[model samples]
Target: MTAPLSEQQLAEIAAREAAASKGPWLEGARRGNVPTLYRPLTSGDGVSTYPSVLFELTSVYGGPGDMAFIAAAREDVPALLAEVERLAARVTELEAEHPSRFAATPAEVDVYLRSILAEDTYLRYQQAIGSEAVREAMDDATAYRNCDDNASKKQAWRSGIDDALGYVDPDGDVGPYPSNLLCSQHNGFGPCPGYPWCTPSQDDTEPGDPS
Candidate 1:
């Protein structure tokens, strides 16, 4: 996948765009049956004319389409660059507001998900057990899990689950289950307790639980 443009790259593009000739450039009369581009000029009299030739399509392969694209780019590029910068700023603001939505890597996403699971577990345990120590321990575990260094190391089970879910092994090499089958327990209500988020019922056994 193509990496997102960095701020430096965006700034460099903006610099190039700023250095380019001021636009709203116009298509001028064809020269020798070849299309031409011109920058609009206005004198003190306020009469506008396309006297300044910006580009002349002299290449044997060049056509009207090429000339049109080049002329349009003069305006399109700046507008697009401005929009990119604005969106980038908005994304930064949104990431500040909701960091989970902006998880850029698999490891980061895993940590984000795990943190949510931890919070949910904490809340459930607090309600069920009513113990402050359990809550504190859950908080500690969440903080430890969220450390940047531990993100990748903690994701081993993600591959296993993905394999089980047929994401990695769609051919069913990981298990007998078909890729198309959805868990009966996870029907619209929420994820089952066998997974990370749910609380197991008395009849339910957590995945990989020997009991």
Candidate 2:
């Protein structure tokens, strides 16, 4: 009687089969037509378009002092996308080898999965870096939205906040208090707890006030 193939022999067979099955898809992916087994980015808005994540990363206020950091991130985007594509190609190669006559060993799948994850993480890092400038621009554009001169804008902002607060606290009336102001008399530090701002007035010193 013929002996069954050993695990090592089985692994070899699986690898060969996977390689053959994945060749067509791999070729297509090289031309940017990666099959269903490979999807690099869900949104095909093009590389030039700003991703939401990139927008968020650069959205923080840093003034002219942050120019260097933003520039550095923008430089990293291409590098990140390249790495993402590289890993995606590898994943497709591995996945195409699926459903072979021989059972695919767990170790083979694990290595492929790890490669995909590493590339994806690198891509995200690059995108965040790329979006820094766009985010900064967005922040700068809206910088004047809170100025005292822009009373209409400020009122709109306050009204929105109040509406949100009311929605959350339907039983109570919520208004913009001193604690919510941008500058305070306390050296512009923040709202003082001693002030009757967001907190209710304390009449503890009044004798028999609550008895």
Candidate 3:
């Protein structure tokens, strides 16, 4: 497959489009079976005429499809370019807000997985507590949901849940623990509380250790 167009290539295309004559251009009266492009002109009296020829298909190889596309591109290119730029900007904004969504590398994937686990754990804790104060605090802390600091707030919330649930940090790090250990520690029981699939037999490893 061909590589995607870069911002520079897009900008170059935009520049060419801008430099081209303004459109609402049309295929003018054919000259000896050859197609010609004409910019519709409006006189001071408001009469429209196709006297101004913008381009002509002089080559014998050109067809009606080529003429049609070239005529339409005067306006279509700019509109398509605009949509491309808007989508690119939105993707950039999303990447900035939640970079893990676009993670590619193994380490990045691990971080993304950890973040998902942390968020799930944090949400479960909040739901179990069912306290208005805690909910309000979470909302306040993450009010600027698109901001970079929101990530830190999420980490803080996860840490708080870890402390409240008495999670043992086997790795000596304040990040995601193994799912089996998390489930076991969550309810002070061997079986996972919310997750029906997780059982002691399925994960034979001890609470603080992961195989």
List the RMSD of every prediction in angstroms.
18.9, 27.7, 14.7
lDDT of 2: 0.39
Winner on TM-score between 2 and 3 is 3
Q: Is candidate 1 or candidate 2 better by lDDT?
A: 1
12-92 in candidate 2: lDDT tens per residue? 444544433221121112223312222122236554334443221221233232333334445345544565677677778
lDDT of 3 by residue, 1-211 (tens): 2345667866765665565555655555656766555544566686764555324434342345555555667866766677778778879898888767455653355455545655446435423433443455456456545456666766876665545333222333433333323344456433344343443354554444434
Sorting all predicted structures by TM-score, with the top scorer first, yields 3, 1, 2
TM-score of each candidate? 0.25, 0.18, 0.29
The CA lDDT of each predicted structure is 0.47, 0.39, 0.51
* Candidate no. 2 TM-score: 0.18
- Residue 59 Cα positional deviation in candidate 2, in Å, after optimal superposition: 11
- After the best TM-score superposition of candidate 1, give how far the Cα of residue 38 lies from its true spot, in angstroms: 21
Report residue 104 deviation for candidate 2 (angstroms). 13
